[model samples]
Every structure is written in structure tokens, then in C-alpha cells.
Target: MELFFKYLQYEKRFSPHTITSYQTDLHQFQEYLQEVYQLEDLKVADHAIIRSWVVTLVQKELDSRTIHRKIASLRSYYRFLVQRGLLETNPTLRIKAPKLAKKLPAFIPEDAFTQLLDQSEFTTDFKGQRERLILELLYGTGMRLAELTTLQLEDINLAASTLKVLGKGNKERILPLNASLINALSHYLQLRSATFPNNNSSFLFVTDKEAPLYPKYVYRVVKKYISTVSTANKNSPHVLRHSFATHLLNRGADLGAIKDLLGHASLAATQVYTHNSIEKLKAIFEKAHPKA
Candidate 1:
């Protein structure tokens, strides 16, 4: 188990968040085996035992997505054990993940974002400027919340009008920026300089005390601003990312380009936005067609 974790951290280069999840899921399964079947070691467990745990998870009403992730963790761990000669066969081989219902990514509308950026009067103070920039960066770059949180000063190149994003799997991608985002960035940098002239942290976005911005702080800021412009059930940073991709798709951006900008590993991840784009087209057709 310790060797498998080291492989994940050092060899696979999985993020700490992902590593924690793997640890938690595996630990939960260990406890389940210990408590339910009085099994002290899972190395001897078989597919039937794994399937029983899946049944237990379903009976407990856990989300299918969550269950799927746990299964994935188990699969990976078992693969490691088999390769290391710790187990003979993989127990999770016959286990299949439950089919998950497809749900479109929630996004704020174009007009809502326009109103938030244009009609809204953000104060010129440090906190106000930083908050405004946070919204713009999320919507502008289509970057993930984690990407935004760890954004550093060197990642942005204002002269080139691009951002260097360290995406999933530690992959680096360059994203272009528009004039509006550049202008917002410039203003925010000015405020940041004035507020923390002797700051030590290299993070682009920081708190009032010049500390690195955390996930919850960014979530609350996004929620507060989005609430003023949208009534979407989810008012998180990823909503802005979805809005960015959806808006670009509506404006005729290519799927491959959107995928690259969003730093998605495959076109399948980017294709979800096409469904949203098609829905918009259907709405337009319904409103304009006269042959009804």
C-alpha cells in the first residue's frame, strides 16, 4: 500500500487532491472488508467480495459518480498489487461502474456576465479589484478552480496577451486573452502592487494580507458575484469555465481549439459543450422558424 502510494505520488504525478481521494476510498474499502466479512486482509478477496461492496454502496444511496470513482481507485490499486506480485488476480476486473445520467455543465448566460462586468460598479480598492479579477480570470481563461487558485505571477504574460496554465497531470497549456481580460488584469495588478509592495508570495491572486488564495475563498467570491447576475443552482468557479466554453462554441469556436484552451486531454471532454451549443441553436430555430 505504501509502495503503491509512492508510485502514485512520484511516478504517476497525480495531484495531492487525487492522492487524498485514492487514500480515502481505499481506506473505506479496507474498513468495509474488516467490518462486514471479518476479513483481515483484502489481498485474498475475490470479485464476488468486491461486487458485494458495490451493492452495499448502492444500498447506501451514494452517488453513482462517487461510487464509480471509488471503483476506479480500487481497480488501480489492484493493478499495482498484481504487478508487484502481491495478488494473483484483480478482484475489480469483473466489476462494472453503474451508468451515470448525463447532466450538462451549468453556466451563466452571456447577458448575465456582461451585466456583471459592465453594469456592475466594482470599487477601486484592493479587495474589490482582486475579486473582480477573479471573476474575469475564471470566465476569461476557462481554467479550472484549482488552476486559478494556484496561478502564479510568472504564469501570465500581459505583453503577449496569454496565460500559462498548469492543467491536470501537470500538463502546461497556453491560453489567449482578450482585451477586456487584459484590462481587468492590468487594473488588478496595479491594486495588488499598491497593497502589497513588499510581498514575498509569487501568486498572482492573493488575499488582503498578501497570502495565497484558497479554494473556499475563491468559491465564496464566485458565489457572491454570480448570485447577483444568475439564479443557477450551482454558483461555483467552474460555472464561469463552462460559460467561457459555451459562449465560445456559440460564437463558432472549433471544438479542438476549445479543447486545447480548456486543457482537456480528449475531444470527448470538450464535446459536452457542443450539446449546449446545439440546444442554443434549437432555441433560436424554434423562435425564428415561420413554417410552424
Candidate 2:
């Protein structure tokens, strides 16, 4: 299993978070096989055995999305095994994933973000600079949390006003930095260098101990600031990403351009933001258009 995971990490270029998900799902499936079927070999799993696992997942009343992801993990793993000639056939080929409802992206309004960044105050210190940079990077560049955490100082070209992001699947894309974001980056970098002058880490953001920033700590920073301005139930880092894309669409940014900035492999993944745009258009038409 570790060998398979290494293949995904090195050859497939999958991000750490994705590799972890695949690992968890496969381990769960293996545990089920051990407890229920007295089976220890996942390579020998047949369609009937895999399908029973899906049934058990549904019986447990897990969300359809969770079940869908688990099945997807199995599909990829089996496909990898088959491609390697280790498995005669992919058992997951015959299994169907649970159908999922389409959910619109959740985002804070533009004004709420404006108030958060413009009106909110932070002390003139290292911690304050770090917190502001975290929000600025997530919302400004629309980079994923993992991508932001893994950012190196060289990833940003301050003079060029561009940010090179390492997105999912280890894909790299260059995003233009707006004037405000550029200034924020500059200020944060200055403070970071001054405070951690002797630190050896080259990561753009790090803890007070001069270690690289972790995902949970970054999540807490986003949530803490997001809570100040929005009462939305979903206030995670992804809400800021959705806000970044949806706001761009509302202001007439091209979808393809948005797709590239978001580092999405497909336009279909980017189209989800359009649903929010269409809803905004409907609201405007209902308020302005008058007919007898």
C-alpha cells in the first residue's frame, strides 16, 4: 500500500492532502474486509465484495458525497493495480458510486471582505503581519490552503508582481498579483525577515518558532478573521476561494481566465461558480425590470 501511495506522490504528482485521503479510504476498506470477510488481500477483491462495502457504507447513513469519495478512492487504487498487471480486472469497474446533489459554492460578499481587510485593525508586529498575509494570500490569489502552506519565498516575484502557485497534482501556475496584494506581500516579507533573521526556513509563511505553517493553524486564522465580518455558516478557507472566483465573475472576468487562475484541470470544475453569478443576475432582473 505504501508503494502504491508513493507512486501517486512521485509519478502522479498528487498533493499531500489527496494522498492522505486515498490512504484513509483504502485503510478503511481493508479493515472492513478483515472484520467481515476474514480477507487480507485487497488485490483479490471481486466486484461482489466491493459492492457489499458500498452497501455497508449506505446502511451506515454516511453522506452520499462521503460514500462517493470512498468509492472513487477504490476505483483509482484498483485501476492502478490493473495498469501494473497485478490485478486481472478492476473490481470497482462494476460498482456504482452514490448519486450526489449539486451544491452551490458558499462565499462571503465582497463588501464583507472589504470591511475585514480595510476596516479591521492588527497590531504592528510579526503575528499581526502573518495573520493578514494568510487572509490576503487565500483570498487574493485564491490558492488552496495546502498550496499556500507549501509556498517558498522564491515562488513570489515581487518585482514582477506575479505569484507562482503549486496547485493540486503538483501543477504550477502563475497568478498576477494586484497592487494591494503586492503591497501586503511586501510588508509581510519585510516583517518576516526582520523577526526571523536567523531562521533557516525558506517557506513564505511560518510559525513563531520559525517552523513551516501547518494547515490547521492556517484554517484557524482564516476562520477567526472571516467570523469578524460574515455570519455565514460555512466560513472555511474554501469560502474565500469561492468568493474570489464568484466576485471575478460578477465583475465580468472570463471563465477560462478564471479557470487558469484557480488552477482547475477542467472548465467544468470552474463552472460551479457560474451558478452563483446566474443567481445574482436573477436578483437584479427581479428588482429592476417592471411589467404590468
Candidate 3:
């Protein structure tokens, strides 16, 4: 199990968020096996046992995506064991994840973001600058929370006005930095350098103690500011990301170009934003047409 985690972290380069989810799923399944089936070893669990766990998850009314990830985590664990010749066959081979219902991504309106950035007052001090920059990078580049948290100083190319992002599955993509973001980054970098003169950490963002920006802290910072601009239920960093992609699509950005900017493995993942665009069109039509 330890080896599996190390493989995920070191070899597969899974993000902290994903690794945490996998950890929770595996632990829950292991506990279930022990209590319900009197099975101590996951390698000993058969297809029927795995199917029973899936049925239980469905009965509990877990979201399809959550149940899907749990099954995937277990399947990966067993596959790892089998690849190393520890197991004879994969028990999860016959398990099928439930179909997922389509859910449109939530995004902040463009005018709301405009008011948030232009109307809201952010101090010039290090803390204020850092918080503002967090929102800027998330919405400007559409980077994931984990990617922004793990961003290093070396990832930014001031000369080229580009940012090299290490995305999922250890893939790398370069995103163009706009003028506003570039200027904000420049000011923030100066403040960070002056404040941490003696600190040699390479992370782009840091806590007051100069430690790398952890996921929870970043989440809190985003939530705090986003709450002021919008009263939506989701005030997380991901809402900003969705805002970024949706705004771009609404403004006529090409889908393939958006895909590369977002670092999605395929167009299918990026296509979800089109639903939001269609909703926007419907909204505009209803306002313009007077016929009931």
C-alpha cells in the first residue's frame, strides 16, 4: 500500500487533491471489506466482493462521480498488484461504474469579476497583493488549484510572457500571460522577493511563514474574496477556473485552443463549457425577443 502511494506521488505525479481522494476511497473500501466480509487482504477480494462494494455505494446514494472514482482507485490498486505479479487476476475487471448525469460547470458572471477586480479594493501590502494575485491567476489562466499551489518561481517566463504549467498525468503546457496578469505578477514578485530576501524557497506563492502555499490555505483565500463578489454556493478556486473557460468560450475562443490552454487530455473534457454558452445564448434571446 505504501508502495502504491509512492508510485502515485513520485511516478504518476498525481496531484495532492487526487491523491487524497484515492486515499479516502481505498481506506473506506478496506474497512468495508474487513467489517462486512472478514477480509483483511485486498488482494484476496474477488469480483463478487468488489461488485458488492459498488452496490453498497449506490445504495448509499453517493454521487456517480464519487462512486466512479472509488471504483477506479480500487481497480488501480489491484492492477498495480497484478502488474508486479502479486495477484493472479484483477477483481475489479468486471465492475462497471454507474453512468454519470451531465452537470454544467458553475462560473461567475464576467461583470461580477470585473467589479471584483476593478471595484474591490485590495491593499498594496504583501498579503493583499498575494490574495488578489491568487484570483487573477485562477481566472486569468484557468489553472487548477493544485497547479497554482504547486507553481514554482521558475515556471514563469517574464521575457516570453508565458507560464509553464505542470498539469495532470505529469503533462506540461505553456499558457500565455496577458498584460494585466503580467503586470500584477511583476508587482507581486517584487514584493515577495523583498519580503523573503533570506528565503531561498522556489515556490511562486508562500504563506506568511514563507512555506509553500498549501491547498487549504489557497482555498480559504479564494473563498474569502469570491464571497464578497458573488453569493453563489460555490466560492472555491474551481469556480474561478470555470469562469475563465466559460468567459473565453462566450467571447468566441476556439474550442481546441481552449483545450490546449486548459491542458485537457481531449476535447470531450473541454466540451462541457459549451452547455454554459448555450444557456447564455438562451438568456440573451429571451431578453431580446418580445413574443411570448
Candidate 4:
């Protein structure tokens, strides 16, 4: 397990959050092996025993998604063990995770999003301007919070109205910007320049002290604005991203284009937004239909 973590960090270059999740999943599997089978170590376990362990996990009432993640972790771990000569053969090769049900992602309505942005307090003050711009960019670009926070000054092209974002797996993609976002960013940059006249930091968004903005700060700002405008659900940055994708899909945007905009690696990852759009269509049809 330790070597697997090293591989994830050094070879795979996984983000800290992903590494943490892998750790948790593998730890749970190890505990199950210890408690159920009384095994001192998993290196000597055979394929049949591993299959039974998966069946036991299913019997524990775990959701399909969680079970699937556990299976993925085990697959990686066993492959590593095989390469290192600790295991003779992979046990997870024949094991299959149950299919997960398609569930729609939660998103704020268009009107609620407008209300949330309208409720944001914009001032000439540096912090106020920075906060407003952060919210605007998240909703405008549909970028993950980590992508936004890691944005550098050179990543944004004001003249072209586009941004170069570094996404999952260290992939780089270009995302177009709307006029409204461009204007907001310009105003915020002017304020940022005034606040730090000669600073060397290249980050687009910065704190009052001229330091790079942290992810938690962005989350808190989003939470504050969301609390005032959205009463239906707990507001977060990801919800805004979901809204961006859903809104685009409803407007007849191509699935491939949406996938590119969201920086998703596969169409399957981008298809979750379609479920939300379908639910919206169903709601509209129910309201407009006159049949008894």
C-alpha cells in the first residue's frame, strides 16, 4: 500500500485529494480482509478469496459507486503487487463491479444563479472586487475550483477572451470567455494592480495582502453569496459548474463541445449533465401539458 501511494504521487502525479480518496478506499478493503478473513497480509491472498470479499462488500449494503471505487483501488494495488513479484496473479481481473444508476447532478436554476450573482456585493475595494470576479469566473467558465485557483496571470488572454486551464491528468485546454466575464475580469485586474503596484506574484486572483487566493477562501465566498440567494440547496462552486454545463446542454450545445469546455476526458463523464437537462424538460412538459 505504501509503494502504491508512492506510485500515485511520483508516477501518476495524482492530486492530494485523489491520493487521499485512494488511501481511504484501500484502507477499508484492508480492514475487511483483516476482520472477515483474519488475514495478516493480502500479498498471499488468492483470486477466489478476493471475489468472496467483493461479495461481502455487496452484502454490506454499500452503494454501487463506492463499491466501484473500491474495486478500482484493488485493481491498481494488485497490479502493483504483481509487477513487484509479491503476487502470482491479479485477483481483480475477473471481478466486476455492479452497474451504477444514472443520477442527475444538482444545479441551481438560471434565475437563482442570476440572483446569486446580483446579490454579490461589488465594491472598489480590492477584496470585494476579487470575490465578485471569482464567483463570476466560476459560473462563467464552469471550471473546477482547483483549476480556477491555480490560474496564473499568463493563463488568461484578455485580447482573445479566452483562458488556458490546466485540468485533470495535467491536460491543458483552451476555454472561451464571454464579454460579461471579460469586462468583470478587466475591472478586477485594475483593482488588483492598484492594490499591489510592484508585487511579483503572477496569480490572477490574490488576497488583500497580495498573496495567491486559496481554495477555501473561494468556497467561503461562494457559500456566503449562495446562502443569501439560494434557499433550496446548499450552494457551492461545483453546483455553479453543474449549472453552466446543464444550461449549455439545454441550449443545444454539442456534447463534444460541452465535454471540451468542462475539460472532461470522456463523453461518459460529460453525460451526467444531460440527466439534469432531461429532468428540466420533464418538468416543463408536465406544466404545459393540458391532457387529463
Estimated TM-score for each candidate: 0.90, 0.93, 0.90, 0.79
Candidate 1 local lDDT, residue 269: 93
lDDT of 2 by residue, 76-159 (tens): 899888888888888888898888978899999899999998887976899998898889888898888888999999999999
User: Which stretches of candidate 2 lie above 4 Å from their native place?
Assistant: 283-292
Q: Whose TM-score is greatest here?
A: 2
Query: Model 2's lDDT to the true fold?
Result: 0.91
Choose 1 or 4, whichever is better by lDDT.
1
Candidate 4: lDDT of 157? 97
lDDT value, residue 249 of candidate 2: 94
lDDT of 3 at 121: 85
What ordering of candidates by lDDT runs from best to worst? 3, 2, 1, 4
- C-alpha RMSD of each candidate structure in angstroms: 2.4, 2.0, 2.7, 4.0
Compared with the true structure, the alpha-carbon lDDT of candidate 4 equals 0.84
Q: After superposing candidate 3, which stretches have Cα over 4 Å from the reference?
A: 280-292
| lDDT (10s digit) by residue, model 3, range 54-138 | 9999999999988989999999999999999999999898988999987889899999998899977898899999989999999
Clashes of 3: 0
Candidate 1 Cα misplacement greater than 4 A, ranges:
38-41, 119-121, 283-292
lDDT tens digits by residue: candidate 1, 173-232: 998989989998998888788888899889998887778998899999899989998888
The candidate with the higher TM-score, 1 or 4, is 1
